[model samples]
Target: MSVNSQITRTRIMECASKEFMEYGYQSANMRRIAQAANVTTGAMYNHFSNKAVLFDALVQAPAEEMLDRFRGIHAQFKADLPKLTFVHMKETAYLGTDWMLEYIYAHFEAFRLIFCRSEGTRWVSYLEELIAVEERAYCDAFGKRGRRVEDMFLHIIAASGFQYLVECVSHDLSYEKAVAVLDSAKRFSMAGWQELFKL
Candidate 1:
């Protein structure tokens, strides 16, 4: 693409990110994004095929990368299960959570879209999918320990983590402050897990 074409595409994505963040996928309008970008509909289409495609362009790479990282971490955790003691488990959990937080920080907008602004998009189910993965891992490690209680714990802890992230973004918390908050939350979550499971 020519320099002008690349610039225009970037502009479209910038405006589209704002639009998606403000109105979400379902309510965001292509025309409004085009207007905001100072480009026509035809110009926008020259870069992205459609609204969903544009939205995907804004978030897909970071989202996929984050999920892939989680999958890798979970695979490692599963492999080490037999040898994991409480201290080892806590260390592993902190490492995994810290890695995830770094990814989120790197792609803050994409995650904001996925976690907070994706109500109408296919990505809306991302959180549920993550929780499902956690549920599966819990089941594998702990056996069938009352599905209702298991789900409740998983959902609450996951929601709390996500909410902390959302607050971090929405309020523009400094990196040090955000990490401090996240570390505290992680310790509290670990304590809850230990108490619940008598680990």
Candidate 2:
């Protein structure tokens, strides 16, 4: 990539991240981000077509990459441990939630912008993808069923139980307390799936 493109992208991410954190997504401004980067609005436009595109590139891209990283690790380490083994569970938990918290800490404003400012509309489908990943892992540990699996997937997401737990641990609790929650969530999710499989 050209140096100018790289610089502009980095500058936009850094400044937009701060701005999005300070303001909700709706209030985020490309002009302000451009100004913060010491670039004119035209330069910002050359890099990103719009605020949505910039947000996706700078914020969503990193978050999605983290998820992919988690999934990759889980797939790799899964076979080394028995189903629900400590290694399996702890690594998975860390990859998914604990690390997610780290991402939030680093990009706290970006996440708040995506969820609160955008009303989480953009995250819904992505959340579904997360559920599918967990569900596949769950099914791998348990037996796959058609209707029941579907129902449980919808139930978990709809109840917002896991999401609520994530929010509670990530935001409402201390870091140590949040780690504890991650531990519990991993165990609980594993146990639940194991039971579903009659394993």
Candidate 3:
């Protein structure tokens, strides 16, 4: 794309972000986004084949990067599992929550869109997918230790743990407030896990 085309594309994405934020993905209008960006609908289409594609363009990178980072954390935790104690787990959880909060704030709008305005997009399932990733990691770690946790129990733990994290973003909590909330949540959860697993 030329300089002008790139500028137009960026403008379209900016306008589209506002539209999606206000009306959500299902009700967001492409023509209105085009008008806001000072482009014809045809010009917008030249840059984005459809609304889904445009939404994907805006959110895909940040969403995938968040998941990849989360996976990396779990991978490292599992690698250290043989010698990991409850203290290690607690420290890791706090450190991970700190990193995750900073990252979420850095990409606040992208996550806001995913959590609040993705009703009709494939991104709507993002929270469920995140929970599934957590659940799988727990299962793998427990299995490797010759321990067994009920699948339903694991799912509940994973889902509720992540929902707490999601609440921080969805409610637009301040960084300090979010950190405080997550710290309390991590302590609660770690206590529960320690009792259940005898870690």
Worst 10 residues of 1 by lDDT: 140-149
- Per-model TM against the reference: 0.88, 0.62, 0.92
Per-residue C-alpha lDDT of model 1 across residues 1-199, encoded as one tens digit per residue = 9999999999999999999988989899999999999999999998999888998998889888877778777888788887777788789878877887787888888888887788767888887766666665665556423334556776676666667777887676777888999899888988988887787
| Alpha carbon RMSD to native, model 2 | 4.9
Could you tell which candidate, 1 or 2, scores higher by lDDT?
Answer: 1
Cα-based lDDT for every prediction:
0.80, 0.63, 0.89
Shift of residue 30 alpha carbon in model 1, Å: 1.6
Pick the lDDT winner.
Answer: 3
Error of 1 at 188 (Å): 1.1
Model 2, 67-179: lDDT tens per residue? 78757855864564354654455456556666666665565555555544553336536555656665566555333222245657645633453474447433646556666
For candidate 3, the 10 contiguous residues with the lowest summed lDDT are: 84-93
Rank ordering of all candidates by lDDT, starting from the highest = 3, 1, 2
Clashing residue pairs in candidate 3 are none
| C-alpha lDDT of candidate 3 relative to the true structure | 0.89
